[model samples]
Target: MTDAALSPLRGLAKLRKAKTRRFSSFDRTGGNDDRLHIEPGETVVIAEHAGAGIITHIWSTLACESESFLRKIVLRAWWDGEAEPSIETPIGDFFGMGHAQTRNYASLPMQASPEDGKAFNCYFPMPFASHMKFTITNEAEHDLLFYYYVDLELHETLDEDMGRFHAQYRQDRPHAPSEEGRTNEQVLFGSENVDGKENYTILNATGHGHYVGVLFSVYSRRRSAVWDWYGEGDDMIFIDGEAGISVPDTIRKPDPRIGPKAKLIADRAESVPGANDAWPPTLHGTGTEDYFNTAWCPTQTYSGPYHGIIAAGGPNWTEPVTLYRWHIEDPVIFHKSIRVTIEHGHANGRSDDISSVAFWYQSEPHQSFDRLPGVAERVPTFRAPYRNWSAVVNKTRS
Candidate 1:
């Protein structure tokens, strides 16, 4: 036989390796009924793999009327028989939607498709050694019906240095506002933040891993009298370094005898300490919208593979909004630990409902997660009053 003809045949033989075959929902039912009906308060273990493997894709569709059902239904996953789940978040938020609302959006690792964004898909590669388990907990009072297919590939063995996927959800009903009577401008401009102690924490983990990104949502509760912008906060990420030294220990406290300008300079120069002096964050973002890859008070919805605003609160920012930012192209790497946080408003001075799902990959035996709040607490209750904030501002300022 000619060498050219033999070369093509040789390539086919190498591609037929037994360890590279695909196993998915199609294989489970042999192409028959594939949907699953979940009762309220019930937990279903959807997929289980006994050896090294990687979940390549996840597709699911669910029907539920409760607007809050998105936050009520929780998804969790365990790797290597860990006692605590490494992935836990409300299904909708986990899928890229927030505030239990769905709409069309696309990202590198996740996407919500057509038909009113009912079709949720994820493309993150979740690698597990020994075994992996995925489950869904229906916390709604009404039953939920869902159809899903988990596409995975079982390999003879995973690489020795593979990190497991993880996701954690958190919420701050109303990010405690600053002292009463403070004007929005005052709150946004009158702060010296050498320390990020009060910033809203997205993820606080200790391990060898890299942060992928986060799915964030906000429900504005700022009264119409104020400039209702929720993104003046800066993103402060502490990765494998000291967050900062405490102001008291780093520099002399402001002296009353000093002039206002000198005192201001002193305050501005003071440093803030974080959880500890261990490893400080290496990544920091200028502002909320800046971190999400947008700027100058975004009011329109847009989506991309890396970062986008899925929901832009209506005129004058009087609506709930959700945004996603995946670091696939620029993953935040860390060797020892990481603490991801951001300000609620400039210097954490705004009170707005905020929730987020932080996604990352890390070595196994991760720190156990705190108990996820019950359904009642997870439900988003802050809805902006239906009024044009612009009118309120014009009347108050004019």
Candidate 2:
């Protein structure tokens, strides 16, 4: 880990052999043309590197006439000449915000800076063994004015234990509810979920790596007797495999004369379904607000280092909200696989516009992603909720 500037220890300032380098959109002929003009339907290779290295930072700013340009433009990265990219998502969503909108917010690993957050920055460490490439594809109508930098360090060879950084986008333009014609109480909590098959998936990855973080955005589409609060959903994360606890037979098999600890472990294992029959959840949380480290259905925006609600909705969730949780200090580890999911509304009851960007690190040979949503679908749509008082948000600015 790199030491902080305030810390007494100087880690990187000491004996680091990695040489610093950067790729930027600078004009070659010594003129003011310090930006690239990317035409519509054009894909531009932002950076390409040979040999082992680690990308430490990425900074970019874009200007286009179309409002949905953020969603239309895609960012992709490949490591070691992989057929499929390790990092892929809409340009706006890749910088830690979603919904094709940019706003002022900051996080430990990523940030959208001031001036209405037009500047996007990312600090995730992306290490490549043999080769690395990053590209941006503009699928919008108008041409793109883009300025960016890919900062990195060149090394003779990277450590074998280093994992490649990855990010994948997924969405459900208002997911389908559990059952129609159900009362508010039934929709909220009356149902029982034994298998968790009906939950909304954030990511289903097959690899040996750690899940670092996720950015989740939601748009409330309907008014409910439950007050249109869209965060009753609980977060459930399945590690290794699904359905049941995955462990060696001796650890959970029926055995007599086992120690107290071993017997308790066995009994707990018997509580769930068969081991291979299902994907067992290793981490489970309370309501949606709780999972993001907030309480009482937050309607106010807050940005922190690890967890934050950059764009909170109106009262009763009348609009959209974008929240994030980075597990830099507490990453979820999995040996074989991991599945991250959450209930739409208690027991997967409510249907709302849900989308997410799952960010993690894994070894090579990762699965290919599903087809990215079209430009129309990638941009968001909202349903105006009932009577959000206009005066409540009128702050007394100094």
Candidate 3:
């Protein structure tokens, strides 16, 4: 096949034998009332399919009674009847921005659309062999008026080569400025990061799969009036056996696509210290901004198909910033395990509010995720809520 055959549109010339379907929250009475009402602390299963199929698209918008509705509302999904959900995260985060807020930004697989970014859409291809389920839980204080549509294609058979979709949300508000009487310049930049042990972890998964993307958000809880640039931290990813998977290379399954595979030296002599242990990781990036495909300290918002900055923070990066990097064209493959991390500051120094939603496809049963935080903990907190955002706008006007 020529390179043209690789184009997604090229397959349209041939007809397929799959039945397309959609599950929506439509009024059964055939009225214009096309919304689902979910009371406080209620869980609703939007769709459930029993058979081989692939969920191709999902679109949703909602009205909630609480201000932190995005974080209070949670989305969960299961494939092939796994007791644990393959996907679980806050609604706003799942749509591709963070801090329990939304604005217009479009990624190849996900988007929070216009009308002020209230519309949420996802285009990830999720395949299931026996069954699939999707649910939404409203942990908000008040009721919810939700509108949604789940689109999928049904088939008699599916290839086992494809893995299931997984997305996880995580947050840490652990760092604060030093009280050791140091200048802001020294506090932010003067530190040595030897190993990435103290970095903010984005994804730590065990299985045969590839990491596809990251939705990283940073909120500054700066207590001092100084430069708050936290992007100096480097991005490091430990692959396979390097991530501390003691499994031998002989037993692990080969990756579906052709590429590099992790090889473990299972027969290490007890006499040799740290024999052949890999260091510095297989994937390392220059800085936090560099990993997200931006440079020279982002000061504005941008959204592209692969990588973009959705919420470029203000003055000295003192506010909150949202960035996304999707490895659709270049997924980090791992046969046994993968550890994706980035420093909070150069050499693990500054502590800022950091959160992320890592999305990928992995063979089931996947690693168990840390317990999702409650509403009180998951709610996004802001440090620079400057009204009219004059600093950012006037910076543009000038």
Best by TM-score: 3
Alpha-carbon deviation at 300 in model 3, angstroms? 1.1
Candidate 3 lDDT tens digits, 33-150: 9999999989999999999999999999989979878989999999998999989999888896788788899888989888888999999999999999999999999999999999
Clashing pairs in 2: 174-352, 242-278, 242-279, 242-280, 243-278, 243-279, 243-280
Off by over 4 Å in 3: 2-5, 176-179, 243-277, 384-398
lDDT of 1 by residue, 232-280 (tens): 8888887766443433435545433321322322223214333432323
TM-scores for every candidate against the unseen true structure: 0.84, 0.86, 0.87
Alpha carbon lDDT of residue 303, candidate 2?
A: 89
Residue 27 of model 1, lDDT score: 33
- What is candidate 2's CA lDDT for residue 48? 99
Better of 1 and 3 by lDDT: 3
Ranking by TM-score: 3, 2, 1
